[model samples]
Target: MSTVSHALTDSATMLRRNLKRMVRYPSMTLQLIGMPIVFLLLFVYVFGGTLGAGLGGVSGGRAEYVNYVTPAIILMTITAAVQGTTISIAMDMTEGIVDRFRTMAIARVSVLTGHVIGSLIQTMLSIAAVIGVALLIGFRPSAGPGDWLALIGVLVMMAFAFIWLSVAFGLASKTVESSSNVGMPLLLLPFLGSGFVPTDSMPTVLRWFAEYQPFTPLIETLRGLLMGTPVGNNAVIAVGWCVVIALGGYLWSKKLFNRESTR
Candidate 1:
């Protein structure tokens, strides 16, 4: 058989195995759907009244703060789903699940691809749910068809980037707990960055971190496409980040996985 055909067969078999596992165990489906929606309701209805006083009256403005929060809320879904995938992958590595897989006849890449694709499927479900709620809250996008296509492209790129980073952590972490622990910095970023509020209101020190962090550019670029705001040329930085993180994380993760497999 040709190498390409063999690779395709391996990937398919791996994907099928993961899909069957997910079918029998539906843990992620609920959490990914529930968590972000909870945040959206909590922040919008509970805390939104408070933010409105200074936010061009989010209560009275033509654009509801829900519109703003919706984007952030969508990100919450991405964070929860991706983090879940990361921790799960890390646990598999630490628990010898990956070792067992490595001993199988499947293509090496298929193992990672299968798990990543499973997580991506879960993310897609979460994305749909979030978008539905956003619509219910009047968070309509004025973007054209092209923007919608571009937005989907951005999301896929974002998903792949996180997948590689998660795989890297899975390979590098020595303990299952540590796999999830080090993500605190990543978790703190969106809140401290422009996701929750305008970075302009933050102190100079905080604003610098908020403005320059990777999430800002990503959030802004996504928000531009979703909200029709002028993200402009600044989006180049965001795209660059996707490429850099995916490439770097993937190389390091593959190396770590190779070393661990031999041990």
Candidate 2:
């Protein structure tokens, strides 16, 4: 086989291996998937009506809150899913499995590639589940087929960016606990942005941060695609942020992986 073919084959094999681990040891994946679902239920059932009353564009009701919060929940799903990638990579590194892979005659990049691909697939599944629950709870969207497709594209881009960033976190951590801790910022970023509440509702300093954060633009873009809200320049900013993060994370992850594998 050619070099590219060899790399593809190796990566596919590693992908399968990681996916099987996800299935066999499902506790971590389940926790990651369940947290967002629980949050969705909690926010919609417990605090939706009160929050929705304060939110613009929607009247006061849990139903309105569901519609408003679904996009944020979907983003939360991505955040949770990428944290799983961090944990998985950290576990493999600390457990000597990565070292074993390094000793084999496989493509050097295959291991990380497999984790990225597998995590992307897992994240999509989690997103679908969250959306399904949202639909059951009266989360109606105004998006057409084209809008849905565009939404999926944006989500995949975001997931790809975060997955690599999480991989870098995994590689930089000396232990699984540290990896999880390192990824906490990612999990919390959605909450800090315009996900659950409007950025304008926040204090001046916080509102400024929320407006300028990367997640805010992505959340705005999602709102536009799903609810037909005005996206304006948020789409461009969201894509730009994804590209920058993906590039930075890829380079950082490659450098970390190479350095660690050599040791």
Candidate 3:
């Protein structure tokens, strides 16, 4: 077979292996999906009234808050899903699975690509679940069909970028536990951004940080798509960040994987 064909075949096999592992060990995936849903329910039912009331131009209610917060929650879902990728990659590393693969004749990149693709699939599913729950809880988006399609594209791009970063994290960690810990920032970043409330309401320093952070643009772009708020240049900025992150992560992961394989 040709080189590209061999690579594709190996990658498909590796993806199937990861998917089967996910099916057999489903708890982690479930937890990844559940955490965001809990946050959704908690914020919408618990703090939504006060928070929604605080928005500048929106009516004050839980229903209104759901619309604003759902985008953040969706972003969080992707972040949380990558945590599983880290764990899975770490497991393969620490358990000598990658070592076994190294001795075989297959595309070297397929090992990492399998984890990336599988995690992306899992992340998208988690996003879908979160959005479903958001809708059930009165999170109504104003997006038309075209807007919804754009939203999906933005989300896929975001997930792809983060999953690669997680792969790098997993490769960097020496232990599965450390791999899990390293990705915690991904989960907390949404909260530090414009996730729960308007950035303008934050104190000056924090507001500046929130405004400038990567998550803020991604969240704002999502909000603009779903709520019809002005997107401005947020879409371009968000895409730029995704590209940088994905490229950096891919390079780092490849370097780490090759270094380890040689050792």
Best by TM-score: 3
Clashing pairs in model 1, backbone N/Cα/C closer than 3 A: none
Misplaced by over 4 Å in model 3 are 56-58
lDDT of each: 0.77, 0.91, 0.92
lDDT tens readout by residue for model 2, 159-263: 999999999988888999888889888778888899999988899999999999999999889989999877999999999999999999999999999898678
State TM-scores per candidate: 0.92, 0.97, 0.98
Candidate 1 C-alpha error for residue 39, in Å: 1.2
What candidate 2 gets wrong by more than 4 Å, as runs, is: 56-59
In the predicted model 3, the residue pairs found to clash are: none
- The CA lDDT at 246 in model 3 is 97
lDDT of 1 by residue, 34-143 (tens): 87888887777777666644567424432466666676676667767777667777778777777887778767887787778887887877888888987886677778
Model 3 lDDT-worst window of ten: 52-61
Ranking by TM-score: 3, 2, 1
Candidate 1 residue runs with Cα over 4 Å from true position = 57-63
lDDT of 3 by residue, 119-145 (tens): 989999999999999999898888999
Q: Measured by TM-score, how close is model 2 to the native structure?
A: 0.97
